[model samples]
Target chain A: MPQPDVVDDESVAAVEAGLDALDTPTERRRRFTWRRAAAVVAPPVLAIVLLIAVWQALWAAAFWPEYQLPAPAAVWQVITDNVQTGVAFDVLWNSVHRAVLGFAAGVLIGTPLGLIVAKVRIVRAAIGPLLSGLQSLPSVAWVPAAVLWFGVTPSTVYFVVLMGSVPSIANGLVAGIDQIPPILPRVGTVLGASRLGSARHILLPAALPGYLAGLKQGWAFSWRSLMAAEIIAVSPQLGKGLGAFLEEGRNLSDMPTVIAAIFLILLVGIGIELLVFRPLERSVLRARGLSGAF
Target chain B: MTATLETSAMTTAVRLTGVHKSFGAGRGAVSALEGVDLSVAPGEFVCLLGASGCGKTTLLNLVAGLDRPTAGDIALSTSRPAVMFQEAALMPWLTASRNVELALRFAGVRRTQRRERAGELLELVRLGGLGDKRPHELSGGMRQRVALARALASAVQGSQDGSPALLLMDEPFSALDAITRDVLQGELLRVWRSTNTAVLFVTHDVREAVRLGQRVVLLSSRPGRVVREWQVGDLEPSAEAAAIEEINTSLREVISSHAAA
Candidate 1:
């Protein structure tokens, strides 16, 4: 609160008046103009187009043997061939179902666990290191243990995905809660927001950016864990997933099918991130004027 | 016209006796408020002016019941005093209207009535059409206006007879540009006239304190003892603007001497 040295009264008054007059009036618009929308979406779309063109050129140039790196057309043929037979849809659905279920479980378990660890010093001290350490351990590493625990069933895949994703989601929540501005909690208390009310209105909303980040990571972990479980702990009764398709491609030496499976997995992961979590993150950060950081 | 005299006879709006607040413990202990005594009558505007570390904010907190006074008693005849911080403190997720609606909601206003009440409060602060806009969408002045509207909305819903709901402002207008601050001070006086909510404003601006408060209370730095009090009746808005200016100049001299020492 250091005050600047006083200048001539008239000059200071003029400058203050100018600053007052310069305050910008905010505009209200219901819908994004096409130009504005295009401004935002154009770059990513252009990058994707550039990428596909490069991929196609590499295939045409015969950069690698067909048995190693299949052509785009060859991968497309594998997709069309399996899709017509309905097996592609079944595998996609199976993987998506497992990922969704695992993500839900992780969120449910992790949110409360995060709140406890964040609010209580003793609980955080006891489990904080372990939670971070668990995040570092790859989801794929859990497949063997999950197979032993659940005996090569669908339950094993579910367990593996949950184990992989839960720590990240919980840790995200804790980080989000921790990062909440100290001013907000004080404001809530003064406004008569009780402990539970503060958690609901102030703590939860403030932590949302971090929590959403965790959710994005949780989904990735779930997808990775399911794929690992399907490939390593395969059971016909558990049905086919993208990992199973990749495994089948390896057995048959069909590089095109393997490439198609890999592409599908990559596409889905990116799609979920863009369509779901990205918007959520953008909205939260934008509300807080932190979108500039992005 | 004598609303202050009328209301003072009714009941004490806020009474804080021997209030003490300290942070940390043992060797690291830092006292924020030490044996402070204050009583704000209904409809009175009291400004607490001091340098940094003067515990102005700590005193405000004690009255708001946000934190307990370590050694003293605080009694509010009405519900808890509504607080306005230096920052707007509006919820970013909510629109300006919904921010006001939250206060109404907590005060037990019916859901159907909240929208109209929120709109009315917005108009009270000259932000009539900006209710749908989020905090980010508003300028700093507009955001603080919304915050003032929200605080007023709470007082309206919560205040009881005799003891008007107290509005504890912790340098709410300090961050604003001078014109906006001037406009808001005018708006606050108008609002105070209508609602009769006793205001306990904290500021380091001596002119601002003289302009806004019926009585200005000066606090010493650190443990924050009440050092002096000035009755600023002739400087009230009802007085001639020239007389108020002269009062402001003298108040600035007092503050400058304090700074020099």
Candidate 2:
């Protein structure tokens, strides 16, 4: 009859099917674009460069006396000299060892204490305020009591660090538990999860972000407490830590050595935060979709 | 359609009698529900349609056993009724399949057959290949599907007496787009027919109530009580679109009159 009746029912059906297939949504892959990576990394590197430049310019202008603000080169010289003599390395090792031990102890004692306070109404009401109050008290204040109790030994330093950091770690966990969305706990109940199982599976995971935040703050406290203990409770029996190095510089009136020690302390604190805590925080936030970038 | 009309009291899956609930105490007390009586027979789909302060959610909560009635009682012939919320409520940490598996596990599904049952449920909801994906990775419609599948799994695993399962839904499709809502309504009907579950759905949308429910129970404003009930006939595709419009207009009139009062 006609020239194929051009658009037959079969042809029309085939066309519609093709359009449906085209309209169907497909999952797309998400990638970490290098441009975004560069954008994130650039600002910090530039700021560091600017800071160094400003310091060098101040030194060039001789704005402050060398005794007050030592030049970058002078501080570098002190680091090199101390390294060659192995003193800087010893001090670094001593400070790191104390900080690590303090952090471990804080986590151990604080985690359980937090769980108890969060779960039990009586315990929370009784000790919650005390825990937060203890966090505000300066770790240096513990030095005298620790010395009176343990004498001028590593144990005294350890005691001071624990008193300083444990409260913050525990409070963090308490806050974390408080912040967990109520839905999760309900889900846990529906699933027949026992109290312990709920704590382990639902409550803990839900509280992770808050807990990590607490750990970050706890580490800072640990570091600061160790330094205070090291400087104030110094003895021949106790090894030289970063704080002791700064004190020795003060005794000798070696401005460059003091600057070098301060620089090392700042560097190590930033390094730990950036390398360890930041990545942990990022992963947790991203996993929960609380962060902008996955 | 005929099947729903023929449902008898003997086939009741869930029944609530003289249920009363109130918040606060003494002089300041606000009643949320009062003397509420309702029943859903096996294989029936009932919608509790109401305005904002109508206690529809409170009623569903009682049925789900999330909260107990201040007075009276709610009884189910089988195990606890499964509930679905406006939000998908899937655990963010688990894959879609694992979320369904969790419900099955809780309902005492055998350990060896849990995965297979979960997979079957995923297929039932048309999310067969999405088992391993996290909730965040799925679309809003997809997440709700997983939620529906999870609720169904719980119902299936726990339902005794060979009766249809009981489902309590609190506006499960309120968050979806119209197209997605339509698709999910179809899916809901398919699943309901296949599983023969008795659904007590709560929604503010009148068209949705007419589209999905065999019986629509309208509730009065605060201190909610049954105000009116309508038995909607078969919403066959040819007449559904027109019927929905007419029902929506009437629902709008009812809401406006209540607002004016």
Q: What is the lDDT of residue B13 in candidate 1?
A: 78
Q: Per-residue alpha-carbon lDDT of model 2 for A1-294, expressed as tens digits?
A: 111111344443344334334434454656799998998899999998898889989988988988887778888999999899998889999999889998999999989999899999999999999999999999999999999999999999989999888999999999998998787777666555567777876788878888888889999999999988988988888889999999999999999988899989998899999899989998788656566654
Error of 2 at B28 (Å): 1.4
Residue A246, model 1: Cα distance from true site in angstroms: 0.6
lDDT of 1 by residue, A1-294 (tens): 222233344444454345434664544444868998898899989998898789789888998887987777888899999889999899999899888988899899989998999999999999999999999999788888777787989888888898888999999999999988788888777666778888987899989988988988989998888888888977788888999989999999999999899988998899899899888888788777666765
- Compute the DockQ of candidate 1: 0.24
Residue A281's C-alpha lDDT in candidate 1? 88
Candidate 1, B131-237: lDDT as tens digits: 88888777788788889988887776666454578898999999987767866776677688888889999998876787778888887766777877778855434
Query: Which pairs clash inside model 2?
Result: none
Clashing pairs in 1: none
Query: How high is the DockQ of candidate 2?
Result: 0.21
Per-candidate interface DockQ score: 0.24, 0.21
Summing lDDT over every window of 10 consecutive residues in candidate 2 chain B, give the lowest-scoring window: B1-10
